[model samples]
Target: MTIREQLDALSAERILLLDGAMGTMIQKFNLSEADFRGNEFLHHTKPLSGCNDILCITKPAVIASIHQAYLRAGSDIIETNSFNANAISLADYDLQDRAYEINVAAARVARESADRYSTGAKPRFVAGILGPTSKTASISPDVNDPGARSVTWDELEAAYYDSARGLLDGGADILMIETIFDTLNAKAAISAIQKLLDERCSADPEGAAAGRYDVPLMISGTIVDAAGRTLSGQTVEAFCVSVMHGKPWSIGLNCSLGAERLYPHVAALSEIAPVLVSAHPNAGLPNRFGQYDESAQTMAGHIETFLKDGLVNIVGGCCGSTPAHIAEIARIAANYKPRKIPEELASGAAAKTVLSGLEPLVVDPAVGFIDVGERTNVAGSRKFLRLIKEERYDEALSIAREMVEAGASIIDVCMDDALLDAPRAMQKFLNLALADPEIARVPVMVDSSRWEAIE
Candidate 1:
């Protein structure tokens, strides 16, 4: 069935079952982190390592095996192992060209696995997964830091499109946009997916009505810190406002905290949308040894608690969760009576913006005038480079924030270096400025006299 149909069915059913961690399952294969991380290029097929994004590239067979295992264990929905199939994540390993290949293959792998594992009894669904970029949230302005760093929207958009297309092409039942901390990126991803769906629909009039795997879209946010807020400092309530605008078939939490820790957040989110509620938390905090020691039984017990209390519609594992954990969850889940969810939710303004998580750098939508200061431009001054580096971030963020704060809808950033790393420094500075939560979502003016800097 298509994503929309599956979601419609879910609303009528009791609860849905999503699978557990692919990475942890792959780790049982004994592969190193680097090998798993770089699998797309190397093309390792062994099951020694955990399930990595490379499966979408090199080791698709392994990815298939894990998906099949979950099906055998009784999961209703198996998430495609394409979490890092986006262009940006691929770029880190210089595999950007493979974004489409990776995502499409990931979906196909899961599809094949679901078909192979089903005993002709219960039906299974495949969900295409999208994860966040690698950049840290501590530097983003939306998180209230304004100092957190990131990449530009244009750069991110191109990547999101490539990945989204792959998932659509490969025939996924749902598009699962998970582990988002920055709301803007989430908007970009969902918009990218919608754009792809639109393009596909536009491409073939008959197919559009037939709903060729035009999957239901699901958006999930990560509450990373101890406070249970996103890196953008959005409370659960604030984040829900942004998510609801997307009109996802379902909305909930994933990654970041373990199942036990995510309890309160998941409960709160379920109240907002009449859609299905899902949570796939990590095993627990990793230890100094980088080991996630939480047992399947323990994880299942916690999931049981949540399930009994009516806290979630679907339950699974995240970072530290394994197939065993999935097995435990499957066993416990079979006993519960399915609950019904409402088909329609209270309507409101649809979210069209591609940026949501950060506070907009106050811009006077009516005018554009930003300031620039030179506090560290002295000869032979190490402090100058340090401060220049700092100010570029500050200015990018502050101006963006100031623009956001002052109500200047647009801002211009200029980098002058009669100083050092004029070109490189300016590039780094502007990149951060553009990425700053304040300006990360806004347009930027890269003012550099050096032609090289512009390049």
Candidate 2:
């Protein structure tokens, strides 16, 4: 069945249980981070291979086994073991070329697992998971000044297109774009996928945009570091306005925080996107060793808030989570009825999210002009000038960081000289800006007088 059909069938009375942690489970198989990172080497040999060689890549059977375990545990929706199946993250292992093959394999494995375990009960859904590109929106320099960045829409779209096609080809029930921090990247990915679907539909003789061919899309963000804002400095309200376009089948929070920390975000999200308020928080905050100490029982206890507050329609796990945790959450979710949010609360929350496209100008209540620094504009200004002149991009980045700290809303970049290749310099700068959350939201104004230089 199509994803929309499945969503239509879901209700607050019945909470959807998404499967738990892939990376955590994979670690149990005794794979080191380096081994998983080695999957990057396969990019040249096979563009379709996953970098997590210990799990979904080298050992497909393990991934299948995990899916079966979750199904046996009674999960309503088993996310495909493809959260890192996107090209962006895989590029670290030099597996950028194999994005399509790896993603397709990931989806197929999950679908097979679900089908093999099905009996008289309802069929479990396969959610195709799409994560952020390697260039984090929260930390990229270009997020503040796009004109100074290296990564372009064309580049990002090309990568996502491959991954999206792979997932669709493998029959994912829904495209779950998760952990999005930058609204622009989210928009670019969704727009690219929609464009592809539209083209395919237009090519059809019957003009029928029917079946799984038109799979539903879900967009979720990670409020990991920020209280309620993404790394791009997008408040929950601003993010909703920017990324809510095309209307995702579901919209909510995931990653970066535990259930307690996620409460306010979920509460606000449910009010804005009442259709499907999904959440997959970490089992709890990570210990110093970066491990989750919470048990399934402990995690399940926290989920009661969702049941009582009616702030969630889908519940699952993220980092430091497991199938056992999902089992408990699912069990409780099955028994508890979700409360309906009051219309007043929901309506007021929805109104605040309406955003304007004009540049976000932060005029401090204390100081009127805020902070604007000129050091932001030099492609190789004194610091960048030295860096670019000496071909020291790494050093130039340090300068960018200082400029951001000096209160530069928009950095003026001029990388047109012999040492700085405009496009590459811009892409690099943008990637850096977008990765840094502090200034990722600042709007950039191009300072180039030449049209060619600006382009």
Candidate 3:
């Protein structure tokens, strides 16, 4: 079913409940490395330890049972056990080639369990998990060169594409990109998902599954701390704007913080984001021993405030949460109506005339006169135009940095040169420019005389 159909079916309730921590439940099995391998890697040398995603293929019963538990506990959504099933994360166990196999099996397992418990009253939906990998794309591994990153855009894109292909093949209803710490990394995943959608629609004009529904997309990020910013140094609002291109089904904060600590940040998203807001925080702050001691009742009590105030449409747990915690959340968070997407936000008016680097350049009449860096233009900087013609995106980023340092609040990115593929040039330069904190910390004004580039 499409996201709208699911929502219409469950229209009686607000705050569609999502399942709690997959890692926490996976630990309950107490499986060994051999169990993780399950004959597939029986002869392999490298340890298969900490490879929870592989359990979908090896320990199908255990994984399905976990999904069953969440469904019984009143969860409307259950995520696939493929958090680390991508090529990047699988390299740790030397099972990179099995990334697609791992994800397909994981999604299939979760789908079966969700279908078993699905009902006309409260149908279950499977969300394919796209995790934030071990590497950071926006931060430099080498402090000496701030622009250096551990992962390239293409690598991240490829991993997400492989995982997404497998997830869809196994019948997932939605794609959830969770625990996002870097907005650029999240962008790569989102881009890959869009690519999948384009390919599917192109191959089958009616869409996969004969036009039943499009796989709804959802993105959840991490606040990181009291700073109220992502690990990439973007405020909650800026993070929302950075990934706005994805046009997610829902956007909110989750993980790294407990229910209480996550409240304010979630509230911020509810106020600003142009989509449904969802939050899944940890049970509570870990104690000195690194154990989550927050009881299920206490966690539910805290999450209740969000429901009472209508700040979230989806709520659940992250670290150290279980079915019992989800049960309490489901019991208390019912009857409340889903937070309505404001007519203005759903119309996407907030997306226009805004270049968000560190903060948004909100181009409304209320703001002061904005300074747009016009030097990236052919008329202003012959060197910039020349570099664009040659496709030197790296050098192009340097020019953008200079423009930001020159006191411009918004970078007027013009890729309208006839010699260039305007759309490709615009996408390349924006990807590079937005990855730079110096440029990303402000808004970007996409300028083009050609409608193709503007679109």
Candidate 4:
């Protein structure tokens, strides 16, 4: 059977076991700065210490060993050690130019290791790790300037395209975009993957028609705090709705919180998400020294609760988890069946028009009318237009908040003033709006006659 068929068959039989933390396992090796550099960058100007992704090229054997260890621990799926292998993140070590090469090496290492453990009855799979890059597109870096952005969507798309291409070339069975703190960044990754699919379809129409180039995408987001929201200020439902357009193979929460704290969010996802749900929470919340304190047995016990509740189709560990933790999880997982996808969702009978900003707004006749506040529109409100011209975004955002407070389910924003750079103004105002949860909790409608502004 093909990898996709194997995955379907296996997941249908029982909960699939994803490997535990790659970073945690790498920490055990305790290699020095020189080891990270190796002969690959002996004379490079920038220090390369602590950049785990670099090991894919500099220490392939080490990466392979980690993958092998996870496989031995009964991980049906092992993620590549390419979490930070994108151009945006690799720029920190001056290896941005080698992003594609590093990703290829990472996936190749994991692929080799997984291949070593594959059997007809029990096959192994590699999930190419697409980490949320160091920079965020939706959030501003400068606290003083809420409208400012460190990275553009085009740059993110380009970087993710390179990384995805390399992973695909290196034989990854699935493209796993993991640890997402920003939904916009995840959108860029999805866009890149779609572009790849388009290119493949164009190159081999017959193969594409035969479903030969189809790849399963697994998306996992992180809840940044106890509030059950991402760093970009999206609730679990909003996050799910935002990315549902990508049609992922699975969606779930990972990193940040431990299993106990993350349980409610995962349960929430399992209840609503039409796709498969996966979770790989941290062993436990970190101690004062930033160390995971939960033992393997303790963590497994928490995961057993998820299994008993039938909340996950895939289960694993994240930060601070090891091969032992995965072994425990795999052993426990063997006793439970995977969560069944909803029949209505599977039949496409539950499809609806859902829009999101920081929250989701499902447009249904049963839900009553949606009130869209247009006071934020520059063309509609002179005061809002004046605020844009004067660069008083705070006051403008207050108007948006007031609209939501006055019973608006969606906020309509338009920057169409003759005196303003409409696209720039729209981008600035929307970025600032997204930074404010009070305003972003409702969906946003970017109203513009100019396609550039809408884009």
Candidate 5:
């Protein structure tokens, strides 16, 4: 069945059960460096011991066994062992080139296992996990300069595209960008996924555009400390606003803070998120030795509060969780009903996500694009500059008016030129254009080359 149909069916249930930690379970097999190597890189110098994603290709049986354990524990959805499958993360082990191979192998293993365990009542699923790379996109590597970043936007887009393509090819039912410390990185990943969706729909080799990545999408972020914000310094609500544009099927917190510690942030997010909320907190706070102290039963009890409070629709364990933990979570979740979406959101009244003063942008779960016009730039348009230079304000205003008529949700204005008085020109044009009802409705982007003019 299509993923949309599966999501619809699952939504009617009290809650969906996501499997527990992959890294935690991988540690169960007492394998050394050579076991992780599995003949893929026997001659390589770098240590491949912690690179679990490679095991999906080198030790397929081990990965499949993990999936089966979760399925037996009653997990409705099993994420592929592809969290570090992207080129950026794999680069640490010098196996960056094998990104696609690793991701495809990982998904195929989970898909096969999920299919084998499928029953008529609760069919299993595979979520393509897009993990945060080792490097932060928004922060500067050099402490001296704050603006200098380690990774560029294009690099992130390419990395995400490679991972998404691999996951979609291997039959994943959903794309979950989890453990997000940076919202900018998540946006880059979401943009790549959206581009893949658009390309599939527009470039149909066969008669029908029915293709891969048509699965449900979920976005999960991490709360770093008691301050209740991500590592990027965004509060839970800010994180929600930053990612809600992607229209995720589910949005929640995972990793970082433990289950009980993350309760307030989860409750705060549920109030604003339009879609179903999910949470897969770690196995409580670590002890002095840096090990999870909570047992399977103890962790499940903490998550029970979220379910009873009607704050989440999906629940699971993160670090230090095993099949036993998942089994208990699945048991507790079955008794409580899923969090109900607000009636206004369900009835088509969106929470007013307005961009550029125009009508509110309808952000549906499946939408992938938004258009904004930049023709109002005097720097780019010689004719518009000449019209304004000639003091014909009315004629120059026509340019701005025409862009809105052509379906631009937002208009960009740039009055930066070496010869022209940019501040005066910008102020004059903005006052005139904003006064017109036709141009005033949409939002405006003030694009100026000079710092003074921008201010």
Candidate 6:
């Protein structure tokens, strides 16, 4: 059977076990800057001491050994050590040009390790880890300038495309976009991977028909704080609504919070997400000295609650977890059945027009009429148009806030004035509007006569 088929069949029977932390295990090696360089760049310009992704090239055996340990401890799925191998993140170490090489190496090492552990009855899968890069597309780095973006959507798409292609070439069974702090960044990855998959299908029709390129995608987001919102300020439902267009095989939460703190968010996802829900929280929160204090048994105790409640189809560890943690999780997981996917969701019967900004607004007849504030429309509101012309964006965003405060479920924004660059003005205003939580809690209706401005 193909990996997707096997995954579906096996997950329907019982909860799948994912591996524990790679960085935690790598820390045990106590390697130096020289070790990270591996004679490849002994006299390089920048310091390469703590770049863990580089280990796939510098110390393949070490990475493989870690994978083997997780597999031995009973991980049905092992993620490649390519978390920060994307061009954007690798630029810190001046290794941005080698992103493809690093990703390929990472997946190849994990692939070899998983293959060794495979059997007729029990097969292992490799999940190509696509970490949220150091930069974000939705949020502004400069607090003074809400419209300022550190990274563009195009840059993110190109970086993810290169990393994803390398992983596919190196034999990854699934692509896991994990620890997502920004929904827009995740969207970029989904778009890039979709493009790559379509290209592969076009290049090899026979292979596509045989399910050779039918790799599954698993998306997991991170809840930044106790409020249960991503760093981009999206609620669980809004985040799901934003990325559900990707048609992921599974969606869940990982990183940021520990198991106990992350439970409510995962529970919320399982309730509404049409796909399988997975959770791999950290081994409890960090201590004052910055370390995970939860033991294997303690962490497993929390995960047992998830299993008992039928909240997850896949469960495992994240930061600060070890092989022992995976063993305990695997042991407990064997006792519980996986969460069942909703029939309506699986059959496409639960489809609805759901709009979101930071919060979701389900447009249904049951919920009265939706009030769309049109004061932000430049063509309609002279004041809004004047504000844009004067470059007074901060004051302009206040108008959007006023609309939301006046009970507008959705804000209608338009920049169709001939004197203004409609597309540029629309983009700038929307970015600024989304930066404010009060305005972002409700959706925005992009009203534009120009298709270029709307797109």
What's the residue-level lDDT of 148 in candidate 4? 89
Cα-based RMSD of the predictions, in order?
Answer: 8.3, 7.0, 4.2, 1.4, 9.4, 1.2
Worst 10 residues of 4 by lDDT: 1-10
Q: What is candidate 3's local distance difference test score? A: 0.85
Clashes of each: 33, 32, 10, 0, 5, 0
Q: For model 2, how does the per-residue alpha-carbon lDDT over 213-313 read when each residue is reduced to its tens digit? A: 66778888887463687766677755766666656777778887888788888887776564567899899899999899989998888888877877887
- Using TM-score as the measure, the top candidate is 6
Q: What are the per-residue Cα lDDT tens digits for candidate 4 across 1-455?
A: 55577788888899999999988888888989999999988899999989999899898899899899889999999999999999999999889999999888888999999999998777999999999999999888999887789999999999999999999898898999999999999999999999998999999999887776788999999999888999999999999999988889899999988998898899988888998999999999999998898999999999898899999999999999999999999988998989998888777798888888787888998988989998998878999999999999889899999999999999899998789999998888888888888888899888999999999
Q: Kindly report the root-mean-square deviation of model 3 from the true structure over all alpha carbons.
A: 4.2
Better of 1 and 4 by TM-score: 4
- CA lDDT of 398 in candidate 1? 48
- Per-model TM-score, in order, reads 0.72, 0.74, 0.86, 0.97, 0.79, 0.98
Model 3 misplaced stretches (Cα beyond 4 Å):
1-3, 8-12, 208-210, 348-352, 366-368, 375-407, 412-439, 444-455
Q: Write the per-residue lDDT of candidate 1 for residues 1-455, one digit (tens) a residue.
A: 55577556654565667898887787777766555556344553334233367656566666777888888777888998888888777666666677788788888888888767655446778888988876532345355644335676567667787887888678777888898887767877777877787888898889888887356888778897767778756666557666665668778888877778878888777665556777888888788998788898988887787778776777778888877888888888777754344334434243222223332232243434443333223233344455666654554344346555554434444446554567666555654564555544444445657787665
Tens-place lDDT per residue, model 5, 1-455, is: 56777776787676998999999889889879998988877988899999999999888899999999999999989999999899999999998888988888888999999999998887888998999988887566776544456886678888998998899888888999999998778989999999987787677655234544466889999988897867766677767777877978899999987898899989998887788999999998878987787999999999999998999989988998889999999888889999998888666575565342422344344665656677778768888878877768788889888988988777888887777888777766776664565876566789986886665
Checking candidate 4 for backbone clashes, the offending pairs are: none
Q: What is the lDDT of candidate 2?
A: 0.70
lDDT of the structure predicted as candidate 5: 0.83
Each model's lDDT: 0.68, 0.70, 0.85, 0.91, 0.83, 0.93
Greater lDDT among 2 and 5 belongs to 5
Tens-digit lDDT track of model 6 for 240-305: 999998999999999878898888889899988888999999999999998998999999998888
TM-score of model 2 vs. true structure: 0.74
